[model samples]
Target: MTVSRTRRAWIAGLMLALAGGLTPARADEPVTVFAAASLKNALDEASAAWTQETAKTTRISYAGSNALAKQIEAGAPADLFVSADLAWMDYAEKNGTIRSETRVNLLRNAIVLVAPKGSTQKVALEPGVDLAKALAGGRLAMGNVEAVPAGKYGKAALEKLGAWDGVRTQVAQAENVRAALLLVARGEAPLGIVYATDAASEPGVEVVATFPEGSHPPIVYPAALTKESRNADAAAFLTYLRSPAARPFFERQGFGVIGTEKRS
Candidate 1:
């Protein structure tokens, strides 16, 4: 979609929501959200609509959701938490950081292969490419699989294809998704594995392929309100997250809509 039309759609949606009293909150007070870095672009755009529709500000902090979940588990101040997967959300909910009923699937994404700009080397999809040769000029970038959801998905998919142990020792891990993307963008790494949305941010990178959907458990995002939040605006923000105003932005970023509709 054209950037202008996307912007106009956002503005029109916000205006319509406000006129229809869909969102109602005070602008001076903001809801604080801890979100996965993979959502950086889409959420930034969607959050603006929530702000305008409700007259409430949303202050978002992006990072590996697992790290943020650990912080929240250790008492971080946040009105809401949006996790890249259910594991982290389950951790928070189990620890009493987030209300159980508030936890709901938001979106899903897939793992994709991307290489630096102007690189002609194409990654062969047979049992994973030979890392040392395929990424001959630089390290292949990926998030730390221990905690980054994108990395976890990548690893799981690789493991399913019987290539994990073979490539494990040759890996170059980054702190988070964005760092991995940067590795490829700056030519520090010849290729990187990040969410489809994360790769969309850099014209310097191009996706070579996507892991088959059946390769790993679906990559799903979940959001929830926390009991520690005293902000009255938090509920309004959560509601806006599931609205039509935010749906297309998720699609524009290549995220699958999370609902009863399954991929057929």
Candidate 2:
């Protein structure tokens, strides 16, 4: 009887161990997202709302679109990517880092000139506008014009309006648009060229003028699933981004929703 009881106890312990090993881990791991810095405020709010409803979490990394695209190409593990422009998204897609079929244009924005809040600076953005004269010997803050999407758009608009030649030397290029906006807000730069949404997000800056739509390529924010994504909730998160529940946060931040004609 003693021998039999001992054997039964050993078998029961083995069964418990096997059962524990076979049990699956939790199913709600956070989805990792790499997104442009410009989307920080709106995306944060959207992610919060998503988590509340679905009980899933999201981890977002925000930076310049160029930097984020290069990191994705270098094998960063990302479930989703949101770019400030189509060009960087194109780069990721070309490198096979992004799943092209999953890509969608998610938002739109406009470039505008901004000044320190309460400043009386205003200028009409027209062809041959003397932007240098408007600078009054102060530096003009902008993103890295060679790479950052906001800077590229700002440069393109200036070039199209015949203002680049005059103000090119006075530019204080920042790593990203938000940084540029900060320069103006801090009075380090008297003027800044940034997305209209960016100007609106900061209380210390005010929109002075908006670039003409024809001045540069249409500003579109594109989002896609990365090839490295292992998250089961990634596709659902992408869908949620376009859902009515998420639209309000983006719109409140002055971003034009995809399929909608609103502009800030």
Candidate 3:
């Protein structure tokens, strides 16, 4: 039997969940979250806090927004989804994978160029900055520009700054922003483009420069409950993320709070 790509993706996600020790959720089971990889640190902290306060546990799976959205569409039993961009959230909404009425813009972020901690690279992100010359025959690490939000945003910024043509051939694409960040952090690539929050979370990498505002689409994180979720606490967990209780966790990681605020 030939497996369709969508079905294959669904199977893969199910396998991963089972491998991670997840079972069919019951009312007593933890809230399952499929979140963008960039949200790991902040979300982890916020969710832990929520657990401390409510005694309700959570199980979160992190990946690129595109991959997560596809997994959700493929029938992964995730209770909540937080996407790195509006497009992916829109994708999930359009496919009826999420409860559209529960959707809201949750956070904002910025992109930046980064280098390994010991590297002495300084860049001014502007028109004609000669990004290719700065690479000095090395690769520019980034997420898969075609399918990943970070890569698309990075590509747009580079194009806007007139640097895309110069460094087009030297690009090294990764599966996600964190993987791209690892390339630079491990000194595999002299430079990488990632979210400001990602750079902040990795001590091995240092920000070289921030992309100018308006260079790319505004970075927004939209979140919602999955359509199939039946966990009684899922809605509360989603609300907690927008509450004042969760704002500091996100802010400490350099993410801006912009969701409809909820009372603690």
Q: Each candidate's TM vs. the true structure?
A: 0.85, 0.88, 0.89
Q: Write the per-residue lDDT of candidate 2 for residues 171-225, one digit (tens) a residue.
A: 9999988999999999999999999889889999999999999999999999999
Model 1 TM-score (2 dp): 0.85
What is residue 148's positional error in candidate 2, in angstroms? 0.5
In order of TM-score, best first, we have 3, 2, 1
Top-down lDDT ranking: 3, 2, 1
If both were scored by lDDT, which would come out higher, candidate 2 or candidate 3?
3
Candidate 2's TM-score: 0.88
lDDT by residue (1-264, candidate 3, tens digit) is 999999999899889878966554565699999999999999999999999999999999999999999999999989999999999998998999999888888999999999999889989999888998889999999999998999999999999999999998999999999999999999999999999999999999999999998999999999999988878698999999999989999999999999694212
C-alpha RMSD of each candidate structure in angstroms: 11.0, 6.3, 10.3
- lDDT per prediction? 0.82, 0.91, 0.93
